[model samples]
Target: MEEKKSKFPKWLKISLIVIFVVGLFIGWKAYQTFMGASVTDKEEYLYINSGDSYEQVFAKIKSLDIVKHPNLFDYAAKAMDYKDIKPGRYKLTPGMNNRRLIGNLRGGYQEAVKFRFENIRLKESFAGLLGKNFEADSTAFSAILNSEEIAKQYGFTKDNFFSMFIPNTYEIYWNTSPDKMMARFHDEYTKFWNAERTEKAKALDMTTQQVSILASIVKGEALHVDEMPAIAGLYINRLRKGMLLQADPTVIFANNDFEIRRVLNRHLTIDNPYNTYRYKGLPPGPIMMPSIAAIDAVLNYQHHNYIYMCAKDDFSGYHAFATNVAEHQVNARKFQKALTDRNIMK
Candidate 1:
């Protein structure tokens, strides 16, 4: 063996030793880049906008100042051929290594936003909320929502297109398109109106939209969930008798004056289709995005002869119901006096 080793030159031996040391150093660095924690303390987010170049993505990552050893990340990114940056809202957790971070960016593994909306009364307001939660702008969303042709495609008119949006929390991607979002809503609305719910609506001699309309009135009438069924029943009784729904909330909605504390005689004269006091049946659409509880209340409304409701005089968020005009007048007088005492004269 000594004789064989003698054939090796000193330079060759030195070269081998140097190469071994360099290899060890390179291996250690690679391990640190791929396995060691790179993200700083606390969670962070990286928003790679659409059409962003790799350089732009790197700039954003650097601007966040969350990554430790950014050069190492760059090296590893290049080594893994992660040259393409996908657009998304990526969540970077603490203790995330460069490999995992790059993997997320390359794969476009975005975080879903918890988009929620309820009690949205106007189409513009609903569009604004959707814009805030998604990539679509308010203008674009509103235009699409107001398009008669688009509404007809979904089996709705522009005025009633808002009924398709069942108010609830939705896990939505940040970059969902407007049309895609509407389609999802359509699917959700269909799923919500199942065979059982459809049969219930038919039993009550109401369409799905009609039920939603009544639910909206009930929602606007009372804030207390426990009283929703009673309110719904009162409206149903009124509907059955061919009497005016006379829902005060509908008058307020028709006047477009949400600030009105009292629906005075002046507000009632407004010629709007939403005015249930004037219109013989349900409005063209829901006055507001009715809650699921309100919708269910309409479906399971308590059978009663009550055709009238007035806000209670005690300031509790409950209503006084009556079957006769005389009893309703007494309840209304009490409420009017309370309103007068508070100086809520308009």
Candidate 2:
């Protein structure tokens, strides 16, 4: 026999030994690298949207070359317990290996920034806020607010811009246009209107426009939520009595700022239609976007004969309510004294 061929050929035996050793090394490395290191290729950009199934997401990762293999990425994502990722634009970088990449992508790395609109005075401010994200024309926004045609179609005259809107925190997508955002805000207001509020307005012999006007005034006056209904009641009483609302906020609104050291009898005579002190009733429109609390105060106002209120010098945001001219004058004097002491006089 030819030296009895050893049970195994030399090359075959050598190959088997090499294969086992290689397998052992790979196994140890795999065990050591749980959710292993990221790949070191060029960075890739990916836009993942919600509603993508895991397989679909895997395909996107592969197409972007953000991962070396779809199957591996999917397996790692599953192993890492990745699920239900929100869809959004993601900046994928090199070194985002199967494990690291899946973790970051599935962990929701997208950032969100909030743009708040509170106590904003004019339509221009709103347009300006929107301009920070998207190219917006403040002039156009103002024009839209003052557009007789748009206002007429929407049942809101140009004068009613502020009153027609309700102030609230709105989460808008980044980079939204001023015009489109304003339209959306109007839609939100429309959704808030109910038949009960409508009927209440009708019963009070008030139009939505008038109610919003009063609500805006109530918002400007009542720094505290509890005071809104009482303040609203005062305005309502004044309206029922055919007395001028005589609201200083209206004058300040007309003046385009609240810094008027004193509402001299002259300031109240501003020719603008927003001059409620000069007008016989509510202003032509809202002075600010009334909060829901203000709107509710108008709708479910407490029944009262009081027609005046002054801030309680405590700055607790409460007010002093008065039922007669004498009492009102007393409260007003007290508020004036408080103002003098604080040197808030302009």
Q: Which numbered prediction scores highest in TM-score against the true structure?
A: 1
Clashing residue pairs for model 2: 38-97, 39-97
> lDDT for model 1, on a 0 to 1 scale?
0.87
- Model 1, span 36-130: residue lDDT tens: 88988644677767788988877777777868877888888898899877887788898899999888888889998888889888899988988
Question: What's the residue-level lDDT of 47 in candidate 2?
Answer: 56
Q: Compose the digit string of candidate 2's lDDT tens values, residues 1-346.
A: 5576688889999999999999998885564344455454654455565477777777766676665555656666777887776565555666556665666566776533345666766777766655553334466566777777877766788778666666676666443455666787778778778788889888888887788878888888777888788888888888899998888788889988677855667787689878887678877777886677888889989888888777787767788888888998998898888888988765
Model 2 misplaced regions, further than 4 Å:
1-116, 134-143, 175-183
Model 1: what TM-score? Answer: 0.90
lDDT for 187 in candidate 1 is 94
Poorest stretch of ten by lDDT in candidate 1 = 41-50
